[model samples]
Target: MAEWLIEEGIGESRAILVEDGAIVEAAIELPGALRPGAVLAARLAAILIPGRRGIARFEDGSEALVEPLRGTLAEGAAIRAEIVREPIPEPGRPKPAKCIVTEAPLRPAPTLRERIGKSSIHPPVGPDRFEEAGWSELLEEAASGEIAFPGGALRMSLTPAMTLFDVDGALPPAELAIAGARACARAIRRFSIGGSIGIDLPTVPSKAARQAAAEAIDALLPQPFERTAVNGFGFLQIVRRRERASIPELVQWDQAGAAARALLRRAERAPGAGPRTISAAPPVISVLGRNPEWLEELGRRIGAQVRLRPDPALAIAAGDVQSAHS
Candidate 1:
């Protein structure tokens, strides 16, 4: 699996999808390489997805798709992406239009926004208990209206060291270990990985050791699946892939934006001291927008009750781009 780092951070942000590489038609940015400091966007409360059927329309209509996602964010964090495009579209289809996308931070967690899934496992699965084996496979499902991918099985994993996945060039891998890794991380994204991952796997691994190492990469990168450095013993430390890019791409960005506003606006109206329950509870709510009043307006626009909080201001910021499952 692979992890990205956003160089700048996003503040009061939202994603803008560009289409045919122009504003007339919008498209959302997908992730490729991310810096360490700007990885927080994936951890934010909501992500907007632009579905296959509505890519151009979503932007042309500016009708954001309201798909719930699993992430949390502050304001002014810039979301950047490094995508590996498929050289060709379907056999009979016209070539895809070149596209450019960007994300702008929103106000502090929007008071009213769509509810993504909640944190399934909190405090995380520790490193010492790696061998206990009581962990259930992460099954994808809906915490609310939004759905989680790779939910059929294989939950996300986490490791202490940063994982550096060497994607041969800038393209998606098609094999199982690589495919599964890309698929998993693109679906569930709960844990953080460290260290540069070097992929030396051949098109086929003749030895068991080589095969296991590949498996370990897939297993150890997602949430709940926690571990440290893969020991040199050659035994792979396989785990679930990091879940991301599902709801983001499944729905239209406009729809997702509206839902996010609705969710946050409700939260902004909340009379309680802490956050409210949305299908499940999120650690924090993201009120991403450029203006505090706009965020407040968003909350007020919603009938629900939650107090809105302001985010610290910053001159330069960046957000994280999500990896896609498809």
Candidate 2:
């Protein structure tokens, strides 16, 4: 049976799904997730498709496209809306979100993680109940892009449109394809990589061989995924439903933001704290500097003042949370 272990920290939350003592799927919610069912006030930013589609800006610097059920809307108009889809960050483009205009704030819907936690089938476990489950090591591998399996390896790369997994090793093409397919499925679920995915396997000349490879993948990958058959060039395409950005994207496009949230999580978890301070690179500090609410909440949670110090010499994404007196 699969069990969910949820850890709710200041500014963020993490839910890990463990089955047979191994993590299979993980979901993380960051600050300003803009998750579906969240009601927020938004100002119409622009008329993209004239009346059909328009962009709206939220107070938290997030933007979503608004589609009213009825009535005319114009630029700079204030509207209460419910998030339909969370914003997705695009390379060199604005983060895009979608919403439906509402006259009043509707009751928020349950998030995916929340629903999973409350499921009678997989109830959530206590916080830190599975700290020894090697989650850090697994996440480290997922972020690194290189995953090794029994007979082959997967080189995962993220692109603006889709994620690519290239299989490589000295094993026989058929054997390597089978092992690589299973590994790719595991990586996709473990890292929570969503949206478009492409897997490049070793070329198998025979039609039967290729079919076997595809079957191997089908057996391992779960439902709700649309995939194409392996082509002559050994390229397979799979599309998964995406609501939120994957772990790699969060770490890639928003290193400073991720580090700052991580710092706050660390500071809030510190024990026997008189006062705790986070020291990070200037960019990280600057990112956190924009939000004082997190610090204020930390003080209330820990019953101590919290501070952030910027160090020019520190590397990006490198930060320390320590006693203020240290």
Best candidate according to lDDT? 2
Poorest lDDT segment (10 consecutive residues) of candidate 1: 134-143
Structural similarity to truth (TM-score) of each candidate: 0.23, 0.82
Where does candidate 2 clash, by residue pair? none
lDDT of each: 0.27, 0.76
Please give the lDDT score for candidate 2.
0.76
Clashes of each: 118, 0
lDDT of 2 by residue, 27-74 (tens): 777756478778887788888776688888888777887775334777
- Candidate 1 lDDT over 90-129, as tens digits, reads 2244223211223534222211112112212111113311
